[model samples]
Target: MEILDHLDKLKIFIAVAQRGSISAASQELALTQPAITRAIQTLENAAGYPLFTRNRSGMQLTQGGQILFETAGRVLKEVSDATLRGAHVRTEMAGTFTIGTYESLAEYLWPDFLLKVQKDYPLINLSIRTDSQRSHLEELNNGTLDLLVDAEPRHRQNLAMWPLYTDRFSFYATKAATELNPETAKNLTLLYVRNAFDEDNVTIESHLKSAGYQFQQEYTFDSFTTVKRMAEKGLGIAVLPQRLADKEGKLKLIKAKGFKEGFGHHGIFATVSPHRENDRRIKTVVNLLRKQLS
Candidate 1:
């Protein structure tokens, strides 16, 4: 296939960009770091964009690198996804597969995921429900939903989870707003989504409270979009997913040690009923989802 051929050429590029370093990429590909570095040099000559901008943080993808990464993700998905599709033949795969997830992830991430599933398996009815992860997990157990994709589904058992990606929370404020730290952040009203579960203990608010982080005036919104919009207008400082904030590009990241130390990072997982974990339909979707995001 044309897509497969294209993916082969970009495999090294994609692996390096995804792992953020030649060493990590080499480790993943089982190649020497020097070999990885030399391959990247070759790729840079062919690609119009330099592909990476190295900093102290490692190989940050340049605009061109980012573009290449996304493009490769779209095409290589046909291949990286082979884990799910590798051993399973889809010749007779046909059934309804429903994915239930939270509001923001569905809006920001799932368009391509669901679209690819539909394109590949037209016979299977694909549906997506975006209410709440908690309810979605329950629905999976009830057979109302086939997959529950969320940021670390908790408590419930008998479901097998596959890690897809990570979305970290960050402190965002108007570009003009005062720079924030744990102490100064208290001076600004905090706009955040209400914790869906108080007992979960994994929520941003719970972690902040436990860390002695304080927000003098706090506002809770049922929707993250509302919180983001309000924060953009300088209404208050907000803690939001870094991916969402990057898309807006207007909110400035606040340099708070607490926010910077990875307290808010959560792994996004695709979960399914254990019984159907190896079903062709399930594997196809999970690996496809992994390709789209990874």
Candidate 2:
């Protein structure tokens, strides 16, 4: 069997064993249930034995599965450490670097970042994963993500974070929408990304709350692009990052009494799993990104 394919199967097996169910592993890894099940079956076929005993209680790993889990885990860790160590000694950044971040920032930064990195380090392979949510430490800890650029998460002790820059947020609406002073701002409908309310690191709700505006009507969207588009069509006032808001010519930035200064700025961070703190290739990527933004 190919080493890469074997390692991929091992990863699926480890996730299943740790999560105790195929459904949970599928959810965590963003794979379909059948795909995860097929990986397990393929691994079992290769081993010439059943790895998990199926039951209502959940999958119980057999002796072979337990042995494979312990050994494969060590092998994965060792391979990662060796790769990072080699990267540290190399003169040029070369190797696969996977990064994750929020979609809004990715939309603004990724195209330029990708071009600059490829121009400087042609040998390096870069992969980017963008999501609407703020918490990606799970992917980082699992070794699927090499680096992340986002607002610092609330539970931050698990990963090492380097503060990159701050991006302020503000209220915006279509130019045709009703004028919003402090008194009128509270009456206008609100539209925003759903993660803004759910994530502790994001302060959209906090800013509105402090301004004493308890919006009676609100629209939540998963995409900042969509939120901005809706706001431009006179749907509602959207709370958006300053950079994103500035790009929309049809949208007018609100200058209410309490919010004239902008909602607030959150520090964007370049983060990695603590184990990669000393890896030079990763550091180079982070520094290049900082320079691109600067």
Best-matching candidate per lDDT: 2
TM-score of each: 0.61, 0.72
Write model 1 residue lDDT over 240-290, tens digit each, in one string.
Answer: 877777774888887676555445556788888776788876887888888
| Predicted structure 1, TM vs. truth | 0.61
**Off by more than 4 A, model 2:** 1-8, 11-91, 132-135, 176-179, 194-202, 214-216, 248-250
Which candidate has the highest TM-score of all? 2
RMSD of each: 17.4, 5.6
Error of 2 at 227 (Å): 1.7
State residue 232's C-alpha deviation in candidate 1, in Å. 3.2
